[model samples]
Target: MTEISRRALVQRLVASTAFVSGASPLSAAPAPNRSPPPPAPPGKFEFDDVVRRARDLAAAPFEPVAPPLPDALNKLDFDAWRDLRFRPDKAFPIGDSFQLQLFHLGHLYRRPVTINTIRDGIPTPIPYSANLFDYGRTKLDKPLPVNLGFAGFRLHYPLNAPKVFDEVIAFLGASYFRVLGRDQRYGMSARALAVNAGTEAEEFPFFREFWIETPESGADRATVYALLDGDSTTGAFRFDIYPGVDTAIEASVTLFPRKPGVKFGLAPLTSMFFIGENDHRFSSDFRPELHDSDGLLMHSGTGEWIWRPLRNPPKPEVSSFLDKDIRGFGLLQRDRDFDHYQDLDLAYEMRPSYFVEPRENWGEGRVDLVELPTGHETSDNIVATFQPKDSPEPNKPFNYGYRLIASLNPAKLSPNGRTLNTYQTTAAALGSPEPINPGSRRFIIDFVGDDLRYYFSDPQLVEVVPSTSQGKIVRSFIVPNPHTKGFRAAIDVQLEPGQSTDLRAFLRSGSRALTETWTFPWRAS
Candidate 1:
């Protein structure tokens, strides 16, 4: 098998089996017998109780647990794991609006998590059964234990079709969960909290237990409560998720740190960026771009919208924008044209862009973007989060709340104008004869919206405000795009050798801003 296929096969195998064992497949060992734990006490299962439990757990050192998979069952490959499907009839019913599905433990997911159903303020653990799964090609000579916990959980609802149920949200990896809007596929992932990200000693806090509240009949929303545990931090998170054309999750988080001065990242998003219009690493048979997200969109407190295109660089790069009481930020997949992504199966055009809007003032901090080098698009290499300027003191409690909007449409923070596209070409093409020079680069930026069209049509009405550091502007022009009905700006810049340039541009009509500020970084080779 090829290397890619072999790796995929191994991941599938590991994802399906709960554990690895050296025991014989036919040898039947008596299943471990254990009593069912008592249900959570009444009125003792409030959100504060969840936080208290997490804080208690964080007071102790981190303890890793091993999955309980029999050696015979652990040896099952991807195909075998696929055969072990969950029985449809045994699916957990969560009111009329949503249902719950459990993922089995195996290769990719070895850590088992506790799943509980909260009904009328009480928490009840859901026990696992071997019969709940239909082991397809894998032969199981002996029955499995009943207490085998789940790997993770997925939330399902009528997302696209009326009669068919689709998975809208999922909680799997370390405190990581993904949600999809109507007709939108998963792209970026959001975490409950991030501690020490982009640092040499980073920590991944995980959701060890989840409490899914049973929805009422005809309810349009579902509530999920989770307990986050890490080496130095503990948190309680409550998510009120509404799935639709624009799926939204309103989250309230309370964190207690085991150690003081821990850097906390709020509303953190993770994605992948292999190549795009700005950075084309390899020649491919498909379209010109391949990425989960194209740019980082931010709405500053001053009501200015900023678009920063994502890049896959040769080394790790971290950029931070300091702001106080920020409004919102997200990783957007603005390019929705199917022609942009030739791969019809993955449907990159239909992937959702997640925006995090703070409900209240978040004080002072910086929106940090981290881009890492990746050889392929399959690996996630982009991270964006809000890093607080002041670290929370150890043993001190902190609370943060935010609303996440997941949609296929671009965020409408302003009705005026926004960035449509950004591209780079040879500066020499713009009247320069030195076509082989590496320092000469021309950038083309397009701004679209109703305001731009209104301002540009009047003579001497609109002017392009452009600035650059460490570069000289050779030529600049603004014109209307006949195809898109938008204002396009083209600028030729000559960068100094061994120097990087930061370019900023915006459209204004007599001091009235017509478009969002466009900022980009150019590094000379």
Candidate 2:
């Protein structure tokens, strides 16, 4: 399927499972099983137990269980599917600060995922029942299956206010899940794995079952484990989630590949870049810009910081940054000004940026950025992930760990000066009589930081360094921007027709660097 169709399908699935308000909190009976077998002994369940299951599954041939939806739900539309809302009164209380809600299966979400609650190292299945939901306005032609299971689930906590519980994280479709910080709206998502992403034979690895551990009564964090299954691989995952002003999730993943030489993208991030400061192709909208993430930020092993501005290319584009023992990377929404987006309801300015800090050494790998062509703002089209130099041996355990931070504060992620804005225009200055050269482009990059303020007094001491892979740099210089209290780097480049260039620029003061390297890929029409 095309990227557009894939995104559209996910959007529909997400809309069908959005949360709805309930009347009051009420306690319900223990979730009855679907004639389940005897439960495992207490204290026998742990991370190793899930790993054993993944290994056994990988040893066998892959079996898909895409059961057809019931007639009552298969024909339902968006609004109809959304009407099957899980009762908030039925929310499972994990501790004093956390509660869990389930999603009903319907619409584009046809496959069912098994959910279990782990207490005292004992797992209990949460069965499906019509009484668990309130189907409003939609008439059911037949009763649903007892083993219908769930589409996915979400966790709630007091993130913003003390009394009222707000949604902190949600796992709804595929191997996709999104988390939010205090005061931030949902934006991008973090996936378990991406197999052959941005290619015709791309595969999606999904979580077939989940085990959520009940935290202690006064505990501040929750632990959830998952068993992932795909045609290419089987894996186990553990998320120790801490929700607060800056929500952090410590993730431990173990993958057992089913086939040899299959490309895998670990700790993948998926987002949208419909329009942004660097993309000026679409200007008919009243809002100036719309995007979940504006750029890809990475810290290489050699201690170099690079920021690549995202673009909505006319065709698919993929860029890879080779590294060794990589430190960290993320998709960031740096433009927090509300005026820049002119969007009130969506609150694009309040979207959180997700940064992934590796907990274990990821040796000799490349961070890949995939930008798919997108015409609408609703569907996500950007993906970033880390691919190792060597593929994991089939049916063997491949372990990795990372900390995923979803925060609104982007400054703490890096210490040096960061890219403030990136603008592209014609080579000729505005209102100048110089003939327009369509093949020539001028890029202006502004950087801001505390260290840059010290250089304001000696602006001429800072130099602008620009480089291009397939173009000639006509001119490059640095100038002071009094308004932002920073310096702007401007570069003019001339490119041959149909030629593409990978451009990079940074600022330096004598022997010291002042800002992170700003990179962008440009193609002459």
Candidate 3:
């Protein structure tokens, strides 16, 4: 069956289950789970214990389990779910610096995730109580079970405003977790691990349980441990989260593959790229651009900076940048103009960009980007991950660690110039009677930096170095854009039919480079 038909069938099944459970018609039933048996007893509950549990679970055949959601809780619709609020007084106080708020199971989140709080080296499971939540207008059945568990949890701290505790981190569906920096709204999501993404057989590993280590008074950070389970792999993860101006989370992951030759994506990120300045296919709105991230920024092993604009293509597109012992990569929302996205409620402009910095050398691999076609901005269509050239062998353990930073401001790892904006325009000016050029396309790129400004200020001080692999560079020029106080590089390229071009451009003053190299792929219409 087609993907659309399969999706429709799943939707119908979810609706039917919700209806039978007396939930709202629009609510999706809990995901059909292929559950594993309870883990065997270990001498000690350590990181290895988590991996052992995952491996033992994967050894047995998968069994599906239906989450037990009470009728009253399951009946909540969107509005009703929003109305259910956790009591502030009951929040899990992790010292005076941080607190944890539990989310109730309803609406989109129907399955409960196990949560345990660690204090003074002892682990205690957080019990669920209906009284902990206040159902504003939605009446619920009395005396809910204390063992009902929780859908997810959020971490709150006074990062932005001193008078208020802002939500800085959240753990929701599967192995996904989103974090925010000071004065930044959440955007992209990071996973503990990804297996075989973009391949014919893709598997999503989920964190079934979490252990949050309580911090002491005056402590500025905390640590969270999770156990990940999948059909072919099992893993353990530890994240040390520090929320501030440049919120950073240091993660250490150890994976144990059940079978050999399993492709693993270390430090995977999921985001959305609808319509942007670079590529505008369906332009019915006037906002100019709408996206969580505008481009993929990578710091190569040779200290070269590379920037590739994100695209919402007509079809699923997967691009890979081969590298050896890469330094870092991230999905960056470089466009910070509020006028670019006119949506006040969502505050797309203030959304944080995530950067993944490797702690150790990861041998030859590629930073892969998977762009899935999306009709609307609601669905996340962009996925970026690290694909190691070598596959992990069975029964052996593989380990990797990295630091992830979520910040409202763009990363400043390099002092070199940065891409301010990228836009596409007609090759020929309006009202011109020039002959139409089908293969000719014009692209405008803006570079901003103090060094670039000083170098370009002098007359005849800078030159544009542009190259294309599969296309002829018809024209190229560099000029100062007065509006942005930056230099703008315009280039027009003519491609052959059914051909694509990989173009690269950078500004240089004499022998000195002034900007981080910008690269893009142009396809013939």
Tell me, what's the RMSD of every candidate?
A: 10.8, 9.2, 9.3
Worst 10-residue lDDT window for candidate 1 reads: 20-29
**TM-score, candidate number 1:** 0.88
Model 3, global lDDT: 0.76
Write candidate 1's Cα lDDT for 1-525 as tens digits. 111122122122212212111111000111113232235456657677788887788777877555557666567666765676777778788887888988776645556689999877778988988867877767878766677787789989999998778999998766778899898888778888877777754677777889998866887788888988877788899888888888888788888888877788899988877778766765564677788899988887776777888887766666778787788888999888888788778888888898888867888888887777667877787788988889887676788888888889884544558887898888755575665556877888888885665655662677778878666877887887766677778878777687777777888888788887788777777
Model 1: how far is 76 from its true place, Å? 5.3
Q: List the global CA lDDT of all models.
A: 0.75, 0.83, 0.76
What's the TM for model 2? 0.91
Residue-level lDDT tens digits of model 2 in 381-441:
8888988889999968999988888989888877889998999988877799988776899
lDDT of 3 by residue, 180-228 (tens): 9888887778877777776656666666788887766877787788877
* CA shift of 448, model 3, Å: 1.0
Model 3 misplacement above 4 A? 1-49, 58-68, 71-76, 429-434
Each model's TM-score? Answer: 0.88, 0.91, 0.87
Q: Against the true structure, whose lDDT is highest?
A: 2
